[model samples]
Target: MNIETLTWGTLDIKDEQIYHFPKGIPGFEDDIDFALITVEDGPFSYLQSLQNQSVSFLLSDPFVFYPTYEFQLPESDKEELEIADLVNVRCMVTIKEELESSTVNLLAPIVLNPVKRSGKQVVLHNSNYQTRHGLWNVSQDHFEKGGE
Candidate 1:
């Protein structure tokens, strides 16, 4: 399918790349369908809304930055997404003017069930994580390991 995106122009994405967000992302509720465009050989991906060309979010695998980051997905959310065997988690990344100032949202992570092609942004209830964690705070070893 071809989607017109403000950030990447028109993109021909495979059907597997399209995810159905029944509840949508927190701020963009009406835009339910999104394409998960993964950047090759990196921990980054873009969640681009199919309903709105201008709506797009830069997402990063939080584990790449905070290896020890852990959270319990509410049973309700798991039920909503119909997650069973597999789950994919990615947080929104906010890029600032200064590269080092960029932050990734650890408070709310976008959870997806690839097998079912459904997703939702699950906000942690009692998490110590914040919305703005320094994107470059990780040690050089992380990057050297290519975020293993």
Candidate 2:
């Protein structure tokens, strides 16, 4: 399927790349279908909306930046996505001119059931994570040092 995106122009994506979001992401309830375009060499992916050319989100694995970042997937959400085993989690990233200032939304992560080809942006309840967590915190070496 070919989609015209504002950022990437015409993109011919495979069927497997499409994901259905029944409830849609927050603030984007009307846009239900998106293409999960992944970056082969990096920790980033593009969630591009099929319904809107201007709607696209940059997603990244939260764990890549915050090794200790963790969250529980609510049972209700699991059931909704019909997730049995395999699941993919990514957070929306807000990029800035200053790379150090970019933020990732940990409070609400985009959860996907690869087998079912479905996804949801689950807002974590009873969690300490915020919508904008610094994308670049301590250096990567910090994790190697195990925080000293």
Candidate 3:
């Protein structure tokens, strides 16, 4: 499918790349369908809303920045998204601003069930993760390994 994006303009996204968010990303609840676009062979991916061309999110695999980043998805969320296996779910953190001065949201990771084509942002509890962790603080070694 050809999707008009906010940053990259119009591009082709396969059905497999389109994730169905029953309840869209917070704030943009009306736009439930989104496609994960890879801008580069890196950690960054743009979650472009299929319903709204101008709505998109910068997502990053938190594990790359914080090697120790961990979280438990509540049982409720599992049932909500019909996620039967943990391996079927992919996790990503929302990125804000440019890489040098930006921050990554770790407390609430977007959990995507690719097999089911469903996704949701699950806010964690009893964790040290924050909504904004300074990007500069992440270890260079971790980034290097992640990029590889």
Candidate 4:
């Protein structure tokens, strides 16, 4: 199917690539359907809303930056998505940038079921997690070790 994307312009996406968020993202409850389009040569992706042209989120896999990160969602949420196995799950964190620092929302992650084409942004109850986790910390640590 062909869709107009903000980052990719008019592009073709496989039907299997479409994701449905029954309850939608926290603030974007009305926008349910979306397609994940990767940036041309970047690690980021755009979670573009199928219904709204202006509604899109920049997301990145947390593990790409923070390999040690872990998250657990309530069992009730798992039932909502019919998540039966880890293979069906894909986790992404929303990114934010400021003049001084860049951050990622690790407390709430957008989880998707590629097979079911459904998704939900789940907020973890873990007290150890924070809404804004510094992405720079991970970068600095990697750089210090001569790793990219």
Q: Considering only N, C-alpha and C atoms within 3 Å, which residue pairs clash in candidate 2?
A: none
Tens digits of per-residue lDDT for model 4, 6-119:
656887888877899998899899999998876777557778899887888878777776777676667888788878885232345444455235666767878887767788
TM-score of each: 0.92, 0.91, 0.83, 0.80
What residue pairs clash in candidate 4, if any at all?
none
Best by lDDT: 2
Global local distance difference test of model 2:
0.90
Measured by TM-score, how close is model 1 to the native structure? 0.92
Candidate 1 residue lDDT tens string, 120-141: 9988987677787778877745
Query: Residue 140, candidate 4: how far off, in angstroms?
Result: 9.9
lDDT of each: 0.90, 0.90, 0.75, 0.72
Give the local distance difference test score of model 3.
0.75
lDDT accuracy of residue 7 in candidate 3: 77
The model with the greater TM-score, 1 or 3, is 1
- TM-score ranking, high to low: 1, 2, 3, 4
Which of 1 and 4 is ahead in TM-score? 1
